[model samples]
Target: MIGILILAVLAGGCRGGSDSGDSRDSGHRPAGGMMDEGTAGQLPKDGKYDPVITLTYLRPWGPDVKFQEGEDQDNNGHTRWAKDKLGIQLKNLWISPSTNNAFETKLRLSLASDAEMPDIISYRGDFNLVRELIESGKFLDAGELFDQYASDTWKDAVEEDPTVWYPYMQDGKRIGIPILDYAYNSDPVMWIREDWMMKFGFQAPKTLSDLEIIMEAFTNQDPDGNGEKDTYGLTFGFKNWVNTWMSDAGWVFGAYGTMPNQWNLTEEGKLEYGSISPGAKQALEKLQSWMGKGYLAEMAGWYDEAKAVEEFTAGRAGIVVGPHWMPAWPLADVKQKVKGARIRAYPIPSGEDGRAGRHGTSIANGVILINKDMEHPEAFFTYQNYLFDHFANPEVGSEFENGLAGENEEAIADEGDQLTNNAVHTEGYDSEKYTVTFDGARIPSLNMATLLKLAYGGKAVTPFEKKVKSGASREMLEAAEIVMVQRNIAMNQMFTGPPTETMNMNNDILSRMEKDTFSQIIYGKISIDYFDTFVEKWKAAGGDQITREVNEWYRTVNEGQ
Candidate 1:
């Protein structure tokens, strides 16, 4: 559910999200503007190929991906877009699962069976799979095509961090383009019921001991005032899943100075899995103890994130951990699910030394690969660069497309006759909508401040901001502000080293073994001391090899620098 993360601009400041103190009068604005109606040097715009370029693709969709009734894989908005606007026709070679693991499995099976891969393929963050795909030599080295077709707007945005290209770089060439998601967007924060805390006359939990007491009160003191033993102190889904961006207990490990789902640099300057450390052992022990005391659900480990959110929605759990966007999602659901439920976000609590270090991912690790046989790699750049022009690039033409008179910068939309950026269309492509929903790459600096400002007062900054402001509750608006203010403070992993050879062969087994051990310990199925044995097995099972490769990568990168 990584909704359109409207970056530093809204879907307008003259164009959209990148990072900000949104001063319309600020010296900073989208660069390179002032256009004549027709420039001789300007190349052909992205739309309606006369001969029509047809692209075959594999669909890796999520459960949330929906079409407007009668519309589906080939005939829906984006595919129709191929036939209509981009002069490209899209063909789905196969549609993979919207469920977790299903799509990857199907994709893996396709690779194994040597099924013909599509022209364009989008994948989630599976570095090993991507590495294998590139190694198979069935894909294009997109470097040359990218440079030729990428628009100035897209080029400028990418300049913010060229290293985003790291994950897909093979033998010094970009084998595929990296799909960019917000980096700190997955960073965990402690979300608690400030309303519940106030009701119980409790202070914010500043340390581990304080948290225990708060959980105690939440479990037993009836914070909901229902006078029943129905509520729990703190709850998150560690049930059937491990760490994810939402409904996760990763912060439980963070409380002990590490987190699951990442690698950390050791004092000796080597990389190590954060989940296998002493910090993890202690964290699991504490969670087991808390479960014993009835501070969490007995089956808490089985709950996927959404079910865990239902606990809060149903007025049962008091605290949850996730990134900033929770307010827009499961938290907001609390209102529809229960009239009195209230929630707020806080900085993830401190460890013994006051370090509340949380984990983060790289900006552009999920992948976009072009097939080697595709004639026009530039087609992707054309369509996506057009997405940059209307949706992401708030400064491309130097106006916000704002409805207000100088309240927000008046945006200059591309004003192309064929289409706007909207995804949904009506009337057999005769069209009722003004834009299209093309997902891939984003403005790296998309800031939240101006969007919040839109909520506080004045005209909307961007149409995107306007919709966001209209939809947000006061709680959401406030939570967004807190997340934005504290985002820079997060401790990013800063490691995009692809899976090493041993890692590629052993990651699934190792990851499963790790999650099983952690889960069993938290559910009191094993002693905390079993972690020592688990660590031994892990090292014996190629963890050592992974460490060696990661260090080599670290050394190579640093030496080059």
Candidate 2:
């Protein structure tokens, strides 16, 4: 990481005249000292400022349009509305019209050129680029900026979990503001075809044995009534790390009280790598048996997430394990392919010892990096505060709802002056119709929960709460509700800090070793007895070193908190 940082800085500084005279000083300070009653720095009572400033941003998408047009900003509804209402113009430095790695190329050119940096950059992808930007020190420290300019609501959110700053932290300062997702992420659950289960006269599975029986039935019973055994029992893709554990068979290890790839604290207070645990071996044995018996998908290792879901939608597979949002995309396609296809989500099945657990990851994804030379670092917080308030109180006529009354109504108003609505519609309804409407002011990527609730028929005070309470026929909501009910049984990873020294050193070897071992065992190329050899190889390949470093990180994180 340090070497990478140095390279990025050298690359940035090599460009000439990129720095303007108004660029931020090496040291930052409050805009106008402490605000007093007479000071202009004080927030206006009317929530409006006379000398509004404009900031340019390089973002992933375009201004809001009736139909999306590549990565152009024309489809970005929120950016346009921000310019209109707040008197803040958010100009796009560039837009990429292609999806296949073209946007990343443009961003790379921007970084390598001598042009001045944009006031802000909202990245949707390319982790490597973000790392380079951080290494350059062109981005301001989000922690200090937040403290100086953030509104009360934004401050509270950042304080909710200090780990939110992990991704953007270089040395000790935070270079970016992370995008917050759920409080506890890693709650993967099994999504089963409800219609198939009923057709086969099987009950919802409660234990690992029960799951095996159900899967066997799905594979052999011809629940689709096609009178042929062409369908599979389960579906999953193992192409990426996200799909490997958090989305697919990762929960299988959870049932054995092992969360693979996570640094877990043992009863003895030692940090242990979950993947090399004895329990993980047990879970692998179970998976091996399932594969040999043809209960698992044959293309598990080859399929990406989309392809994996296709098997389910094509009615060739009966079960999939993923996050709560699975229904919104791949699973929802089942409705078009199979009439009366009903999928039901449930907690991961219990193991032989009655242990049921799911792994949890960090809530924040990446950081929002700001240009250090910006005139108003605090303005970013002010913008975020507005979004937060809207998230908290997403009423029909709220400012976030495109200035249209009852447009994104999650619920109807039964009475006046009430904080809640009686019924809610998903975000794109028009006059109780189910047509997909677009909101130029909507921030869907940042507030998916709110969008989902409006798509459903529930209402609450905030987007988070609404997602917790909202119930609709939508598959995603149903899956979320199921996971929410069993959150207590989930095991959140204790070590979510950046990859440690040993981890960085051995990451490639360990990942390949795990994948190969699991694949070989499942495919009957190696016996379950070989599990011990794999463990030994893991330790020899820096697993032991990783364990030590992970513990150290755990100690440091807890000590400071």
Candidate 3:
């Protein structure tokens, strides 16, 4: 049995695999799941234990993670701090690179063989794998543990959205503790060429009709000089789903009051698939009209998000729909290509009802699981609570104001006046990733709010605000303000659970059909009436059953709330 366990652990280790002795015993107590009453009574109230207990976890690290010389993953500044401050020694049962499915494949091997599990499991990918882990019953009830040991700050963060725990709940028990992230990170804002709009004397678009006028000008006026009607008004990827992270067109469907590629709550108090809603037909008609008028890029049906961005950056397209962070990357490059080019983000234009809707993000980006056979469940929370209380948003001039990597005094002095420099010490070390949660603690609103405030001439009083103000450009701050101003209009996907049995079998076919039909309609290759036929065919092709299963899961989770 020991030989089999060793083989399983070694096979799962895609690179740099290490086993720090047996997971069953860590010299704390008898090899059992929970601490005995006597052991609990003996623990210190200062959030630290005596003699230092080892806490093992299985996780994957990014390939770009770096450490200072002579500081390895298992023996870093974070590990030493945890040991010194919390009396909890952190160890990895096995480590793997995050690329090429290496960590996931390793985890599956361990699960398949029923090998010894770690004290904590840090996972951030695939709700299906989370479901498998829960069903295996090798983990503890994290909700209960959180309630008992979590700090008030941590609990408040989790309670901000109770739905953040939905995907990890099963049979009335919350099996995983959510890793919180910032909200509205992927919410859409219209990114337009300010130069073109100014040249045409167009004001900021407040409604769909107003936007159409600008689109017409961009398409017809040859906004880029030396162009012979070669440019289009807008470009977005449609080869994949219309709703995507970058170069998106979800807001077009949103203008008609339905969002494609997500599940939305209907007025009947049940979840319905958005793609089949009546509003989808109206949105398709508009898209078809745009295609016919040459307002959209030619051959857009074959472009993905990156491909679509090329059209906008190459001065061939004047507008794109994406998140506020565009100014940092591809949008910034546009200035280098076209002289005097100015880009800015604006709130997406509303429909006739004077409301706009775009995709909303879930606050929880990952999950942390605890082992049922672990010796110290509360210790995990003790360590994390410290992270949330101190490192998540440190105060100005505090011990952790510059983060665990420390501050660079030279960088601070050099760019302090401009307030657009990152003064954090990131020279070959990123100790935050070494935390048990993998990315440490985070508050969802701190990042964007800081940028918005800084952009609007707010003073940077706190360390987090100073960090954000130092890094963000004028364009980024302006974009972030627009994002926060329109936060209420974003719509979150209603269904967050793992795929149902029917979905597991039929989703690929349905997704392919949906994408193909939408692309064909936008390209004017098919009649707009064909959308009605597509919707009918979709219901017949397991969409109805998927809806039933989705609503059933929804009711099961929300029961007696």
Query: Top model by TM-score, which number?
Result: 3
Candidate 1's residue-wise lDDT over 55-105, tens digit each? 676646655555567866677544554466556676777876647777778
Clashes of each: 37, 25, 2
lDDT of 3 by residue, 1-561 (tens): 212222342233211101222321221332222445855654565546776788899878887578668977798878988787778899999889889889889898999999999999988886678888988999989998887666655766676677888788877689999899765667879999999998988899998889999999899988987768888898997877788889998898888888898999888889988888888888888888998998998778889898999888888899999977788767887898988888988889988887688888787888999999987677787678767666676644544666654443223533444222322345536667777776688766556656655666766656666666666778777777787677767778999876788998999899888988988888888998999899888989999999999999889877857
Candidate 3 matches the true fold with a TM-score of 0.84
Error of 1 at 434 (Å): 14
Output the lDDT of residue 164, model 3.
84
- Cα displacement (angstroms), candidate 1, residue 108, comes to 3.7
lDDT of each: 0.64, 0.61, 0.77
Off by over 4 Å in 3: 1-46, 68-72, 228-230, 292-294, 298-303, 352-355, 407-430, 555-559
Return the lDDT, model 2, position 394.
42
lDDT string for model 2 (1-561, tens) is 212222342334211111322211111222322233433453454343445657676655422222224422432344444544444555666655336677678877877885678888766466667777887878878778677665444454455566767766788888877765444334577889999988878887889999898988888888888889898788877666422533377678878887776666678887787877898888888887888888878877778777787888888899988777666556788978999999888777889888877776455654578998887655555555555444333434344332222333344333232232222333432221110111111221223343334344544444333333443346666565566556666666677666677766788889899888877877789988898998899888898888777787778767876
- Candidate 2 Cα errors over 4 Å, as ranges: 1-52, 62-77, 112-115, 124-128, 184-186, 241-247, 395-397, 401-471, 474-478
